[model samples]
Target: MNTSLLPTRHWLLAAFLLLATPALWSCNSQTTLQKQLSEHQDQLKQIDDDTIQSYLRRNNLLTKATKTNSGLYVVNLVDGAGAAVKTGNQVRMKYVGRFLSNGAHPASTGYPASYGDPRYPQGAIFDNSADNRTVCGCAVFTAGTGLTAGFGEGLLLSRVGDRKLLLVPSRLAYGPNGTTGIPTDAALMFDIEILEIL
Candidate 1:
């Protein structure tokens, strides 16, 4: 039997049958979902951009504003409290960083918490877990230097025993893309107490 012997009407009917298959319907749904997903992502990007701008605009360290140069704001806190430090500088600090959107504090507690023991559960936030770290001790920013631009600027405004709150905009805190736990184009607030400068 020759396959070419198929009738034109039969071929037309076969084509129609394929065109109206359930798979085509599934494709339509997937296409619609993809379109919606694209639109949602675009909206999210716009929102993130807007949020960054709004935060930057509203940020005015006027009370502690010292200088502004190269897109960096230098704030000098009163009483030499939580001030800025330069890179490679050894400093002792008790810092607490919190997300503006949520009160989740992200700090490496430098200590370990006892797990599974009810008597003396970890006293501090930092537990013995491999992930938990304590940032309370003195840290020397060596080699390439350390801390974010905003944090570096913050040190300059601090004295050995000063304690001040640093309100860092995203541009000053983490820039356009922030670190983990911090959203993209986000504004960060830091409450730093300068224990001692070594």
Candidate 2:
């Protein structure tokens, strides 16, 4: 074998060069892939919201009381006669919180059903349950204060005997970290029934 006669140097250089090219491209390629994934996720979320709004519009359902803000919408339902309420005024109610996308029960508590699993973390539920002296576990919340901005806003819009739906974005509900039943950065849906305001 006349090694000196062969273009071994050129062959080795070409192989090494080819190998180096992919390594460099891999880094850039991975970044591009991540960006595409993010874009797709965002598009899906937008489509989901658009579909929800379209359905609501087509139904022509009355919310009674409604609040829409930044990728979220809240609705309060009252009997034909509208009545208002104030927070810090003890209130009792039945409620069910669910995921808008899947309609899975996320949180529930009260009565015989009250002794069941409450899916998500609710400040009012946790706070009331801590006191055995509390009757019916009525909650005292100050509207526009002493609660998350969404909760406060929703409560303020609610009235006695009113069943309300609070739609909360991550920023107003759980933010970036998220809670037990809710996924990270997930939007929230709450169906609340106001039994009494003392």
Candidate 3:
């Protein structure tokens, strides 16, 4: 009720507001980032869908390739002689990964300069087996784990000795924030040859 106490109360309220400002600002900033991420994801999906459709049309693969439920497009180049790969199986394979922006050329010989691997000089090849010399090693991953959703799903659809070309959307690969060597919101194409299933 005293006039003197009014100034003290005002100062206390001002200090409280000042201290709370940063927390409020952080929440607002986080919300903004999340919204941006969601919007970016949508943009990436549209870009990927358009790119895949274009590639399919240009390559005359629209009839041969089958679209999976998750939106992956799988075109089998060779039928496997061995059993089909299943979830939880260990797979050894060779792969060449490239950005969809580089076009749909799947041949091993002529990759764009921008997409060439320094080690290969001609083109990049990713392998996970120890015996292969042309590539470091064959790609080995447990089906349904330790790999991108697209790649894993693609593997499950293949069998040993099967060669497949996969069109992977960003969400199934690295999402809106891609990892090193892959750009953010970039769609990917993977040429995979299954070598073995352990």
Candidate 4:
């Protein structure tokens, strides 16, 4: 009941509340974001599954395409006669990447210095090797460098001269946070040809 202390007490209370506001807001924002992400992930998974199934049914590839344990769908278009690639082996490959939703290519011409091929036709091809004169040069990378879970796994399953199609879910591709040109939660399709393994 001290009149002098009342103003000081009120100021302290206001300071405490102001200091705690950001923390409270941050907690709520993080929780909401997490929930949204979880829902988005679930939705993307279902959409990817449906797209893959529909693609298989439409193309009569239901029996030809094999589903991996990690949810990737692989269809071997051509079985290679060369040696199979394994982890740590450097690989040279040509690929065309497309989004499963609308079958639009994400890789555009004139971005990466190595890319930008006139043969691809702008907005038609995503990524391709220069050998094909499509989009870019042949992709050279180690077998298991974790560049992309889906692509890496698919590559390991293929051999030199092998051509395969990979259906990659968002989780294995870019997840909810897709890169530029690739939409968030978008599924992807990759047509890859293994040129060499060194």
Candidate 5:
């Protein structure tokens, strides 16, 4: 038995143990952080849902609004006489994109619940097809791809010339990677009118 080699072996064992311990701790810490983020998102989702219900009730739309299986609320203002729209059909339309008048409180929107969002007034338009027509011809999009998931779902429920008001939750809106002026997990609203289905 070489005494010098024995010391080297002991030092190597100690070094291995020290390195392994921190790696294990790092994995545990990462998992904990991920769990916390998920919980926070869940809380925000619940808050948004509650606010949507309150808005519907206060506006007397609780009974009038049709809640789709996936949670999009639609108010069919004008029923179209034209043929029903299909999944891949190209459609010409007009739309006004707006936030929910932001019923969410400071917990999500950073504003008091009593005072509505000044930037996004009750009916103020954040985006509209008339303006976008110069850009990508916003008045047109394929039934399944051009719009957000909730928006597409709403369109599928309509026929050419149908006018609808869609209440889209954040999960179905821009989602985590928000669009310009919109934040993460924000529920949105859209006033849409189908001009023609091509």
Candidate 6:
């Protein structure tokens, strides 16, 4: 028996095993973490969907609400007869953007004017064109640009004077990285009245 080589071989085997163990364990740990994150996101999405559905049901808009391919819900509260608003058109709108607050919202406030009071039943008003109109004239932006993806899509579906309640899922708005006012995973509601295709 080559005793001298035997000990060296055993030592090498031990070193390799020690090195490989952590790599194997790390992959397993990463997988577990990924699974947990995916599950958490799924739960959040379910909660958001439920909240929107409940709001629609409460407002008797379930039948009228149409969900778009990207998961935007548009309820045409007041229909207008005119040419369909197109992308790149300058549109003037009166909009109140809020999150269908989950009761304990931090309460978004401060606008060109006083931000509307936020109560659980009323939801938090992040922005209101009604408040900003005097300061800037009801929001006049080129449609399909400089707006959230959901908002732009909703505009494309409207004509002049169409009053729409747009329920925008987080995925369509800000996704995981929310903007300054919108919270992560927060579903948004835009009560927008198309004033004109300017």
For each candidate in turn, the TM-score is 0.43, 0.48, 0.75, 0.76, 0.79, 0.70
The best candidate in terms of TM-score: 5
The global C-alpha lDDT for each of the candidates, from Candidate 1 onward, is 0.48, 0.53, 0.73, 0.75, 0.76, 0.76
Candidate 5 per-residue lDDT over residues 53-166, each given as its tens digit: 667888887888988877888988898899888999998888888877443433454422334446556445678887864654458879987788999999899898799989
> 6 in model 1: Cα distance from truth in Å?
47
lDDT of 1 by residue, 1-198 (tens): 776867976989999999888788999999999998666445433443333334335665455544345333333343664444655657766665644322111221211110122322211221111233545543433212466766667766566666655545445666435566554434344556666656
Clashing pairs in 4: 107-126, 130-136
For model 2, the superposed segments whose C-alpha errors exceed 4 Å read 1-65, 69-72, 80-83, 101-142
Q: Rank the candidates by lDDT, best first.
A: 5, 6, 4, 3, 2, 1
Ten contiguous residues with the weakest lDDT in model 1: 108-117
- Specify the poorest-scoring 10-residue window by lDDT in model 6: 104-113
Clashes of each: 25, 1, 8, 2, 0, 0
Report per-prediction Cα RMSD to one decimal.
12.1, 10.8, 6.5, 7.7, 3.6, 7.1
lDDT of candidate 6 over 1-198, digit per residue (tens): 768899899999999999999999999999999998787566555555666788889889999999998788999899998778998999988899887632212222321112222332336788888787376448887888898898899999999879999998766777666777665656788998888876
Q: Worst ten-residue run, lDDT, model 2?
A: 108-117
Q: What order do candidates take by TM-score, descending? A: 5, 4, 3, 6, 2, 1
The list of candidate 3 runs beyond 4 A from truth reads 2-5, 102-137
Estimate the overall C-alpha local distance difference test score of candidate 3: 0.73
Q: In model 2, what lDDT does residue 63 have?
A: 40
Name the lDDT of candidate 4: 0.75
Best by lDDT: 5
